[model samples]
Target chain A: MSPILTIIVILVGLYGLATSKNIIKSVFCVTIIESGLILLFLNLGNLEGGSIPILSGLVENIVDPIPQALMITTIVIGSTITALALMLCIKIFHHFGSIEWKEVLGREE
Target chain B: MNDFLAQIPIFLVFIPVVFSIIIYLFKAKWTTYLSFVSQVLLLIAFFAYLSFWRLHPGDHLLVFGGWSERIGISFFHDGLSLTFSFLAIFIFSVILMYLFKFRRKDHKFFFFFLFLEGIFLGMIQTNDLFNMFVFLELTTVLVTVLISYQKSGPSFQAGIYYLLLNTVGALFFLIGIVFLYNVFGTINIRVLQELIGTQGDRTVVKFAYVIMMSGISVKAALFPLFTWLPKAHGVAQSGISALLSGLVVKGALYVLIRMERFLFVEAGFHMNELFFWIGVVTAIVGVTFAISQKDMKQILAYHTVSQVGIMMMGISQIGLTPFYGGVLHIINHALFKSLLFLGAGILIKHYQTKKVYEIKGALKTFPIVAVMLIIAMLSISGAPLFNGFVSKSMIKYAVKGNFIKEALFFLINLGTVTSFIKFSSVLFGPKAILVKEKNPLQIISIIVLGLSCLGIGLFYQVIASSIFGITISTNLWEISHFLDYGLFLVIGFLFYRFVVKKDYLPFQKIRHFKLTFESANYMFVVYLLVVLGVVFL
Candidate 1:
């Protein structure tokens, strides 16, 4: 099922996050994990033969719209977090002159 | 009057936010005064609501747009939530006053700062899970920006680490929500609380509980997920550090208490033993690290972690007395810890150093500040006649007959006393530095906090009975309690003199130990797995 695939995607992202040396790579790994979660949420709300959530006409098996709306909010939040992280990355690189986590974060004050 | 009471929750959240935006857009000189005026008005409104609620005590739920509670967003005002909201607004007002002199012209700082207060208020009052998620994420973003406001290298690094780790944690929380929504078809906590007793599946509920708790653990700065706390709290501006340490972390804890009330406890999940042990470990780790730190801010930061552990231990106990003890400690810790951070900020600013060893004779140099700091220190160390002693004794009294728990409490108390003995070294010795005149606002804020610490300790019986509705049977001012406190002071002084003063090798190792970014993330995942294992087994 796609849920299992989504779990694997999340695991993959965690593994990458655990092993990534570059800060930007870590940021992307977090994005990957978030995307996986988004997929999982959408998949959980999906029905076997569901139509779009619009209820103008007779919509008996419309997929749950709550998860879709929640996911949209999550996507917006996740992207803003990503943008903030990247902005901090730019600042980190400027100050430490390197984007590698080991290089920038490892130094003592 | 009833209509006004209903609108108080919304106004608490929006007043600061609207003011912040107006301040930003107008950039006028008088806007600062307006903001101050609004804060005073909000305080008055909070008191009015509190008095009204006291007159007619019950849960007050306001559903937005007049929709039903199940579908619409709801703000629930109970004693617990209102107490925390009052604390948040109170502390924010103090911090605003503390920063008024220097930061009045800095509109950018006010924008994020006031906006953060609104989000924090919203977080505490909301009863919807998804709305909590949104507030938590917004809090994270606002805190990140505030942490790195200095634009320094360390600040930037700390800010990013906090953002990434907390965002990942929030994502896990979202995943938990997905599972819950799929099963229950509702995200309202009250509705779920009602439905969970009859219709919830055990395994999925347990899984979701573990995942969601892990996310909250990070926010609450539990044992494994606390690496960012010291860094961020230590590196930010002093007022921001006070706000973060005093109120921000407590917001997460309030959520934890709420979740346990509605879900775990209702579901018959007895996580007390597990959380109790976690609390012990967190306390031990925090105290050990705090003793080794030279920076005053870092010591106070780690102490927040340790105090949080004590609160956790109190909260995790089965009885009502212990539970309320923990709740009282949350308020008590907010008061004293903010006082400590704000006082340390003054010392650091005047001395031009964060190193506690380098700065000497605070009592001689800044007499008023030093005196207030000592009051805070005494309160934190559980000295007799201080607020900390009252709550700590309440928790201690709850575990009276259990030998292991009793000893653990003693050991934690001893460690707290020991580290504070080491911290108090700055108060004595000879005056070596000449500092400038004191800021009246700063002094007033700390003095108010310090006096409250004493006043609460002295009047704990009335406060506990009237506000919390709990009558204490254990005599707080008994001779035995004083004797026990004296023993801790003596033993702690000896330990600090012999071991910590000599810079013991183990302490040195703890001082230098730092978790890298990747490893901290790895530890968070490992923490999640450990919680999953424990909950399942």
Candidate 2:
């Protein structure tokens, strides 16, 4: 919920993305970074003590709905890319018989 | 008629989408014909809209869903967006004409091609930042599909690398957008530009700019983030390679220009120096790699990197003249580079090989294509009386009286000439064994592009004025300009014969030096950190 926590999540994602050898882990790391970004956007729009965006008679402090709408689009885009990436990894695996980043290029002529 | 013409931007974007769906669902063999008809219609719409813009000379906004500006998507047209979209349509139509008769029959090719056209049309038209991001993602996915359409060879690997890196880059872009939105509540570009101007320079805003620029640099294939480009452009289908090198990367550069010239114009000078150095480094490294490459496609691929650097260098200068030069070069580079790539494709297909050494005597076997190749080669190398000369000279004239910068620019030109000499070697030597008959449509495509090169050069003033709405004197008739080009050519020829020809040890080492995907990913992190430091420190 805190902005600092989201930054840490992003840093962790970057670390995994940088160090990981497996192609699948790279995709996972991308998803993690996307999640962190979505979380940050959601946090930015939060009212300290707010009700749902849906208008009710009791609605007093409502959260900004723009970022939430933006995150939904971001989530869809991120997931599509992730899905395509994993599919490509499978194709790479089929070609190289290994999905480790170094192994694929090493085994190729 | 006037009222109907007002919605031309909508027609340009949606027609392709509708046609692509039609092509896909029908599975008809005449899908290419369908695509070509739709593109022609779009081109007509563009011409009508462009004439309207010329008469009005202002932004024409098209609001979607009838919502307010702060909440809804909008498409606006001015000169720049119109020119870019026109370029996309022009190039795509040319490609469609060539591919219709020459390429192998595949239904999906038409689908992807049309889809990409529509996406590019939308990319230039949209004014919303989030909408730009969405189109960018769609383009990334579509380009990846087109690149890996062959589904084998190095392209598969190239596709994966391109996909992964670009996805990461897009995420960084999204992060930048998030920061921007938190600071300023709307995602509209014009609104952001006004806010940035009013608020002065904030550290968070500067940081956001750096983050976004880094992300875009990856897409533009600038310096450190360009590892995936050569692989994808060199190994993919020739049409795909030509499209990627020629127009797709320019999308990112367009965003870069908009941001620098509009959003962050106040602090632009601080960032300009950084851009200048990066452009110089990218240019030098690109040409160095190009000089060592034995494969024709790889050589062209590397040259794209160098040429992009040159464009960046042009824009980094503070003057409007140099910036105009940079914009013109984007158009020139797309025309000549795609012409070269497509011409090379014909040769590669005929010979059934990509190695330059394996093929010989192009001038003898394919006289027309070889002539086209020569025109393209000269234009790219900035020979006098070519399209490249006009823009390159403008850039040079912009940085006049600065000796070190002038010399650096000269060195880049020298490198360009030297590498192109090596590339053009296949045109000479004895006649090679002919493999098969060449396609008539391929020759037509080459000639059309070749004529455009000459036409641009001959009508440089008129073309520049019309497209960019700027006028300047071009003294190509002067003797000194001739001598400069002549001297550069002589030096370049000698360099190629003596140094590049010998397979020198350093060249060999650099040629064999591979940047793996993991290391390239590491470089992205380093690039981001360095950019952050440069912006905030």
Two-chain DockQ for each candidate model:
0.83, 0.70
Model 2: per-residue lDDT, tens digit, A1-109?
7988998898888888888888899889989999998998899889898877876667878888889998999989988998889899889888888888888755444
| Per-candidate TM-score against the hidden true structure | 0.97, 0.97
DockQ of 1: 0.83
Q: Cα lDDT of all candidates, in order?
A: 0.88, 0.85
TM-score of 2: 0.97
Candidate 1 local lDDT, B208-261, one digit each (tens)? 898898888889999988999999999998989999999999998998898876
What residue pairs clash in candidate 2, if any at all?
A: none
Looking at model 1, the pairs that clash are none
For model 1, what is the error of residue B136's alpha carbon versus the real structure, in angstroms, after optimal superposition?
A: 0.6
Which residues of candidate 1, in runs, are more than 4 Å off? A55-57, B55-59
Give the winner by TM-score. 1
Give each model's clash number. 0, 0
